[model samples]
Target: MARAPVLAAGGIVLRRQATPLIAVVRLRKRNEWVLPKGKLDDGETPRAAAEREVLEETGHEVSVHEFLGTLVYDSGGRCKVVHYWRMEAGDEPAYELMYDIKAVDWLPLEDALDRLSREHERAFLENVGPIALKAAALDGAARRKAAKPATRRPRRTVAPPPSVSEPDTVPAQFDAQVTQEEPRSTTEAAEPAISAPAAAESQIPPSFASDIEPVVIDAVPMRPSHASRRNLIQRVRDWLRRAA
Candidate 1:
């Protein structure tokens, strides 16, 4: 009867930089450098196992992304199948390295491939390294674009209020008619008459008429003159004579 394959999971963990770096861990017992990976725990999914294993081996918290590829090979006469995912590490490590791991190295793709002890793992990285680096570079660019502040719109210039024009000048003839008062002679008893020009000047245009106030006369009692008193007495005497 054929035995079932040993299930394992891991990550192609990257530290983002100008040029992204990959992580490879050195084993304590075997003293061999290999990709950070481990066997899946009971009831754990491949993705969860990959994230946990990479964190333990690299000591850095990571953000898991899309699935990479799977590796199937013979390990101690047993079929071992390992699943991988793309992951990004934070700037610093969050935990100590696992007891089984001696050290973790962050290296370029070529160096990581060359440093890896297993042939299958090296070949896998070489196949997928460029893909991971390209994705990381593109992701960095997108993040920078999103983080950039938006350009401000220029302020609109408000025009100043229009200047008030000088009030319309009253014609010289109209001014004379308004301000000049004719002097009356003591012997002249007749009321002053308005001339035609004065009447025409009084008919001010509607635009200027709005500024003029109407003249008002108050009703007042006047004392009778000597001539008026003499006329009244004569009228009274004539009426008395007629009655008699």
Candidate 2:
């Protein structure tokens, strides 16, 4: 009967920087430098195993992303299939390295390719390194774009509406006439002097004037007797006859 293949999982883990770096581990038993990977634990998924193995080997917490390709190779007369995912590590390590790993090295893609002990792992990294690097670079750019502050437009200054002038109340000619008049004294105001022509025009009629005879008026006025009143009336009748 044919034996089942040994299933393992790992990552192409990157530490974000100006130029990103990848993680590689030195094996304690074999003294060989290799990509971080391990066989799955009981009831553990491939993706979960990949995250756990990467954290254990690299001693840094990581965020796992899209899956890369798989690697099928023969190890000790058995088929070993390893799955890899793209992952990003934090700025600092969160835990100590596992007992199986002696030391961890962070390096650029070409150097990591040269340092890896196995021929298959190196070949796999070369094919997928550029893809992972590009993806990480895009992610970093997106984050920076989100963090940048937005520009604000300046406010407009509105000028106040033009002032309206009120119309004049009094006419120009009337105002000038009023301003030109001279002030009068108390004596002139009390007895106003009339012109000769005005006084002549205001005189009484000739008929009435002739009839007004000069009669002596006493200082103290007394009531006339009936006989004196009759005499006065007779004199008025005689005057009327003469005028006619």
Candidate 3:
């Protein structure tokens, strides 16, 4: 009997920056890095699955934007079809992973293009590379454009500084112009006005002894063996291992 096709959905969760970045996830056991994706559950829509899987696998809450394309291939005697969408990630840390996902990386567009394992994924990305980059970068100059304008484009050159033929001592000239506009008092002109925070603090009322409450926080007693510190160190190590 022929193996049934498994339907799944995923996202290329991206963040807009100086260089557009795409989020990729690593499996804990296999140590393979790939785009966040998962099999669709019963009654789950492709877009919904894509958003859900991204959050679950990568812990990033992404807003689904444009649909890239479906990648269909045979794996382990079963045909798998993954529908991918371009998504924008929120400016927040991902939720905690369930330990299956080891690490999440937000790599630049070109780096991510090279990072993806599958050739089909690479090809699909290459096919929609320009559009994907344009969508990822919401600006005109930042967009990964393939076709140049019909007219010959001029190379960007640094602008020349303006030549100023003014009177000698520009600082003295500015001082004279300022004096002409506003006349300062003899004392004001003699010394610069120094503002102090203490003047503002005077506005605040002084605290009284009656405002302080007589309360005590119970402190836990430590054992002579320092078992708590050892446990804490081990826990920190475990957390670090998982994070790495």
Candidate 4:
């Protein structure tokens, strides 16, 4: 029986530095430029498959911030669903990407659209362009928000402190319950686990046990031919051994 055409996931990974750069791959023999795509394995979700395929085909670790729906196209009488995602290249490029692709080029948006293989692929790129751009914008906005200092709340000023009321002690039962539920000490509370450098150093040994004398074992023999040893000589040897 013929194997099913794989359900694939891919993307037109876009990066906007000075200009929008759409990552494209050039196939081997034909040398046609197209977006990264690959087969989705069993048990792997569409989004995960898309990200993994992109990373494998082109060495770029990306965050799938948005999904660009699915595309269906026929290949050899089988229907394949390709889940698309808008990915952003992290701080640095994953690795110098090279593949069956003759060359991996980052083309300008217009150039990418014009150079893409099919109308459907072009439409996919167009659909994802806005999402990628939006992600970039949101990233910029977050950075700006982080950089700007937070405005401090105004301190309340009382002209004269009002006469303090007598401390109304709570009931014994209530106090006992509250004490039981609440943390016994500062250490037990949800305060930050801030440790002194000296304390941290003291807690961790200078050298770990594994680091000192690491266990190393030789691998066992695993030859396929070891299974059939029923020759006459072997049988005779086995008989002799059994007799001994």
TM-score of each: 0.64, 0.65, 0.54, 0.56
Predicted model with the maximum lDDT:
2
TM-score of 2: 0.65
Model 3, position 212, has a per-residue lDDT of 36
Tens-digit per-residue lDDT, 1-244, candidate 1: 9999999999999998776889999999999999999999999999999999999999999999888899999999999999999999998999999899999999999889899999999999998888888888888889999999999999999999866985588789977987786655654534234133345454656566456554333434446656676554555454334333
How does residue 98 of candidate 1 score in lDDT? 89
Candidates ranked by TM-score, best first?
2, 1, 4, 3
Candidate 3 structure quality by residue, lDDT tens digits, 215-238: 433445668688867565555454
* Alpha-carbon shift of residue 204 in model 2 (angstroms): 46
Residue 39, model 3, lDDT: 91
Q: For each candidate in the order shown, give its overall lDDT on alpha carbons.
A: 0.85, 0.87, 0.75, 0.71
Residue 230 CA displacement from its true place in model 4, Å: 99
- The number of clashing residue pairs in each candidate reads 0, 0, 0, 0
Runs with alpha carbons beyond 4 Å of true place in candidate 1: 155-244
Error of 2 at 209 (Å): 48
> What residue pairs clash in candidate 4, if any at all?
none
* Ten contiguous residues minimizing lDDT sum, candidate 1: 189-198
Candidate 2 per-residue lDDT, tens place, 1-244, comes to 8789999999999998877899999999999999999999999999999999999999999999989989999999899999999999998999999999999999999999999999999999999999999989998889989999987888788998865876557688977888888566777765444233335434656667566555433445446656676655556555444443
Better of 2 and 4 by TM-score: 2
